[model samples]
Target: MIHPLNFDSLLFGYPVGKINVDQSWDEQGFLEEAKTFQLVYIFSQSELKYSSETVRLVDIKATFFKRLDQSADGCSSLERPNGELDQRLVKLAFESGAYSRFKVDERLDNEEFEKLYRLWIQKAWENREILSLPEKEGMVTVSIDGDSGKIGLLAVHPDSRGKGWGKKLVKAAEMQAKREGAQGLYIPTQLDNLPACHLYQSTGYTLSQKEYIYHYWRN
Candidate 1:
C-alpha cells in the first residue's frame, strides 16, 4: 500500500517525499511503479554496527535548548528569508553528499524546496524535539520513533565547522535521547557528507545502514 507515502506527503508537501522499506518491500512492484512516477529519492539502510564506541555524553549548564528562530536562520541563509518556507536550510541541503546520485530533473528548485523544508520544519517542531545550540552556532532536531532517537535536522555554520560544533550538537542529541530513555540514537546522512558521517562514527554512532531514498511523483 502507498499509505506510508501518502502520510509523508500530506505532512509537509516536501517537493520530494521519502519512505523507508526493508527487504520485505515489494522490490519488483516499486520498480514497476517507478516507470509511472518520478523516482526522486533512493538509498539503502543498514543496522548500526560498532564495538565499544561510546560517545562522551556532556551537557554544560551554560548550554540550553530553545525554540527555533526562523528569522535568525533565514538571515544566516540570506537577507530575505521566506516565512512560508525554510528555504535557507533547503539551499544548504543542496550541498548534501547523496544529491549527486539523483537525476537533475528529480531535484526540486528553490521555491519548491522551500515548501518541503517549511513542512518538515513545522512537523519537526510539532512532533519532534528540536534544539538549537546558540553557543556553538548550530541547530539539531530529533524525534523518538519506537526505541530509537531519530535526528531530523543537524546544521552548523560554515564558519563553525572545524571547531567541533557539529560533534557537540550530535553529542547533545545523544544526551537528549538518553534523558528521554531511548535505547539508541539513529542519524541518517548521505555519502557525500563525509565530515558528518565521520563525526557520527567518531562520536560513537555505528554504521547502522546506508539505504537509497527514491521518490515517486504522480503527474
Candidate 2:
C-alpha cells in the first residue's frame, strides 16, 4: 500500500492517519493494509458510481474547455481593480469566489484561507492575470499558464452573481488566453454549481468530461 499526500485536504475524518489511493489498486490487498493502520481512507476521483458498504461516491466534478475564435484585447495581472472596500471583506470575497463549493475549502481555517489568498495572488502576479470589477459586486482571479494558455481559478462574488459579472470575467480570461497564444482554456467545476457551469457554457465552453470524487473507509 502507498501513502499519498492529500494536497486538496480530502481526508474526511483522520487527516493524519487516513491515506488516499487510486481506485484501480487491488482492493483486498489495500484493505488488508488498512488493518495495520489505526484507520484508513481510500479516496479517488472517477465517474459516478453506486455507493457500497466500503466504497462511496462523494462528489461530482465537471470539466469544460474553450477554443478562442478571434484575438481579444487582453489585460495583465497588474490591472486588478481596487474596490476600496474593507480589506477583510475583499479578502473574504476573493477567497470564496471560486472555491466555496469544494468540500476541502470548507475545511479551510483562517490560516489556510490566508495562505490560499496569498498563493492565488502570487500565482496571478507571477504567471496569470486577474479580472476584477473593483466594486462590491465583482471580484475574480483567473490564473493562466502562459505556455499552454490554460486559464484557471475563475471566481466571482456571490453578491456579484446573476448580473453577468462572471460571464464578463470569463470573456476577459478567454481574450487573455488567446493573446498568450494558448490553444484554449480549460476549467473544472462542481456539478452542483449550476450558475458557474451555466456561465461557462454560455461563454462558449464545451463540456469536456464528467468526474466524481469518492471516499472509501472503515473504522
Candidate 3:
C-alpha cells in the first residue's frame, strides 16, 4: 500500500499531483504530505556533491514528468561527473587512494568504459537524490540476471549504524524502481546481518528467499 502524505492540489489528476514544498516538515506533517504524492523526497544532500552550490530541500520541486513537459530539455538537475562542478570531486576521489580499494580503473584510457561509467553514474544519481552521505552509499549496475531494470547495491560503512540510513536508501531505491516499471526490488545480505534484516522488515520488505554459499580458503 502507498504511504500517506500531504497534497497541495491536483493539477492534472490523481497520480499526477504536486507536493506542497512550502509545507512544514515535522514527522507528522511529512507523513501527511507524502500520502497525496506518489513520489516523495525522503532526504537530500542539500549541497551539490561536488560544489558548494546549495538548494533548499523544502523548495517546491516538480515531478520529473511535469518538468520535462515544460522544458523538453535534455539537461537535468542531476549532477553528472562530467560537469565542471563534479569533475573536481571525481578527481579528488581518484587521487585520494580510495578508488584503489574498489579497484576502479584509474587510467581513463577506455573511452567505452568511461561512457558506460558516466551513464551508470547518471542513472545512480537519478535513482538516489541523497548522495551526500558518506555512510550507506549505493551504486547501480546492470543485473547479471539479464533484466531490463537495474540492480542496486547499498553499502553501509562500518562506522555508521543505528541511524536508519540504510533504510532510507532502500526507500529511495524502491521509489526509483517503481518509477522505472520494475517488478520489485531485491537486496542481498548475509545471514549474520541481524540489523539489516530488521531494517528491511521495518520498511515493509520480507525475505523472499535465501542463498547458500560455500567459501573455499587456501592455507
Cα lDDT tens digits, model 1, 48-137, are: 221221211111111122222212112121121223435444433333312233323334333444455555666665553656553425
Candidate 2, residue 189: how far the Cα is off, in Å: 0.7
What TM-score does candidate 3 reach?
0.36
State the lDDT of candidate 2 residue by residue for 50-148, as single tens digits: 434555554566889876677554433324544343454346345454433323433333344455455555555444265555553444555546634
- Across residues 52-149, which tens digit of lDDT does each residue of candidate 3 receive? 11112222111111001111121122121232324422322222222221123222233423343344445444444323242113222222222223
Q: In order, what lDDT does every prediction score?
A: 0.48, 0.55, 0.35
Task: Pick the winner on lDDT between candidates 2 and 3.
Answer: 2
Give the Cα error of residue 80 in candidate 3, in Å: 6.8
- Where model 3 places Cα greater than 4 Å from the true spot, the runs are 1-151, 157-160
Query: Which candidate achieves the best lDDT against the true structure?
Result: 2
Considering summed lDDT, which 10 consecutive residues are worst modelled in model 3? 60-69
Can you give the lDDT of residue 46 in candidate 1?
Answer: 32
RMSD of 3: 23.0
TM-scores vs. true structure, each candidate:
0.58, 0.65, 0.36
- Measured on C-alpha atoms, candidate 3 has an lDDT of 0.35
lDDT of 2: 0.55
